[model samples]
Target: MLSRTLLCVAFASASTPLLADTVWLKNGDKLTGTIKVFDGGKLLLNTKYAGDIPLDWKEIKTLESDQHLLVKQDATTGEISKSLQPAEDGKVTLANGDAPKTVELASIQQIMKPKPVVTDLVWKGNIDAALDFQRAENDTDDYNIAFKTSATHGQWRHNAKGEYNRESQDSLTTTNNWDAEYSVDRFFTDKWFWDGRITYKRDTIEDLARQRTVGTGPGYQFWDDELGAFKVGALLNRTDFEYSNGEKDNFYSVSGTWDYNRYLIGKKVEFFTNGEVGKPISGVADYSLETEVGLRYKVTEWASLNLKAEKDIISGSDNGDLDKTRYTAGFGVAW
Candidate 1:
């Protein structure tokens, strides 16, 4: 009976999964979890009891993990280590091959899981939808949906986005519009890139019934990491517009565009904004501006609540000027 009990215990131990990553803090607290990633001066750990916890890199005294991870010490160079071993204070040992290497924690720029096969490809995006309906007195209905997606491989990146909005009051259409855009970027260096984009928009009820644009320019990528990303560009565009009465106009324009986002509060909240502004060389339109700003609060790992505001303006159009603004609160899923 004693032998059988020992055999059962050994089998159970062998079948259990291991969560062996450990971190020792400067304040004498020790934590056990799976190391997720380290970026922007924060080391993220996934704990069974507390979900994900972000520890300041400066507060970590030492850490150990058996998982192979990529440790980047600089912008252009990195190495994959078989395991991380605790070294002296403020240092870590990369146990790779027979010769173990030790380095200062402060010198490590980033740490993440190494993807051997698909290391060059990354994809991420989000979708949001909002709707409002009322049945008292004058009936009303409003709906908005939008999606943006991007993928990067090697030195090239591709982006696509689309949005639809519709509203009705008293069984009459008050607003109806949709837009779509696609863009590509080719990196000349780590921070510099060339951008080419095409966009189309249509509004059934507005004076400016349709718009089409094509543009190309140089852009600067300030930074892109686990925390967030920011980029800005200047574009010279060929634009065409069709009015509700079928009047057509075309012009050449110069524009500035920007996209930015940042994560905060242990990745629980995010702030993002992107926009473009342009002035026409001819009199088709004096100036045009389109922009959106938004915030998202993560309700769970993959779910969020979002609030957004958008503005569109076109001055000096032959069919008169155009201006519109919208605000929305909605739910979204992101990855």
Candidate 2:
């Protein structure tokens, strides 16, 4: 038994040399590490001391690898190669075997695992929770929890999200909210898409006991890259609302949604914002708007610290206190 364990350890140690790749920077720096990802003009390398470091591709003079890589040249063209060697005039030689090809570095748009790599449906999500407590002549407690998930396959993307918030003062409920939303997008072109969304929410602070909205429209992706994405959509929607005073109303509206996200500081920090606005064509209110902004610091691959602020405003309200705002800071996990 001892001999078998020792043999396995020795075998693993002998195979370590085959995993390394070499990167040469324009500044005459040479780094040997494992390339994990290269996207949006940045490359991620896993090094012994740095763990994972992101380097701008423009700073790299050359890349040499014996590991198999999937390189996509354009939207519809791709190739698999086991070697990348420098060629003349900003070109690289992709060697699969005896048939070697040269392509310009700027022409390569994306890279991933080698072909025959079966990609399952991409699924990702995050969850966060926060709590605030105050003790004085009157005690107050606040809790907020949120979850979001998304799945993508080919040109179709789907997302679902939910949030719950509650506040109590002197053991009496002061504010409570429950919200959920689902959306789907189908892409026919790189920049143009169709989207549909549904939302349900109940809020006490806004004097809204229940609200439901449904919409579908055309959307445009301004840009979607490794650094971030920006998108805008115009929707025609139907909304129904029930107030706490037992009053009910419904309306048809023209709505718009916009989202923007960016990553900085070597992808360790993120800034995100999204907003929605609607103008009623057959209702009492002139307009309604909701917006949220968030900043997140990635502590690890799956954990982060986040701060968020949100605001909602209704242009004309039966109740004077229909406008609401909130701020929360907490931790989140994603995968």
Best by TM-score: 1
Candidate 1 stretches with Cα past 4 Å from truth are: 2-18, 22-33, 38-64, 70-111, 114-117
Error of 2 at 317 (Å): 3.6
lDDT of 1 by residue, 1-335 (tens): 99999999999999997767999999999999999888667888988887678788999999999998988886545788999999999999999989999999999977888766755346788999888999999999999999998986657899999999999999899999999999999988768999999999999999889999999999999977667889999999999999989899999999999999988877799999999999998888889999999999999988999999999999988789989999999999888
The clash tally of candidate 2 reads 0
lDDT of 1 at 26: 95
Q: What is candidate 1's CA lDDT for residue 136? A: 96
Question: Global lDDT of each model?
Answer: 0.90, 0.80
Q: What is the TM-score of each candidate against the true structure?
A: 0.80, 0.77
CA deviation > 4 Å runs, candidate 2: 1-18, 22-33, 38-109, 113-122, 204-206, 318-321
Q: Candidate 2 lDDT, tens digit per residue, 122-188?
A: 4666798888899999999999898887775556879898899999999999888999999999977
* Cα-based lDDT at residue 22, candidate 2: 78
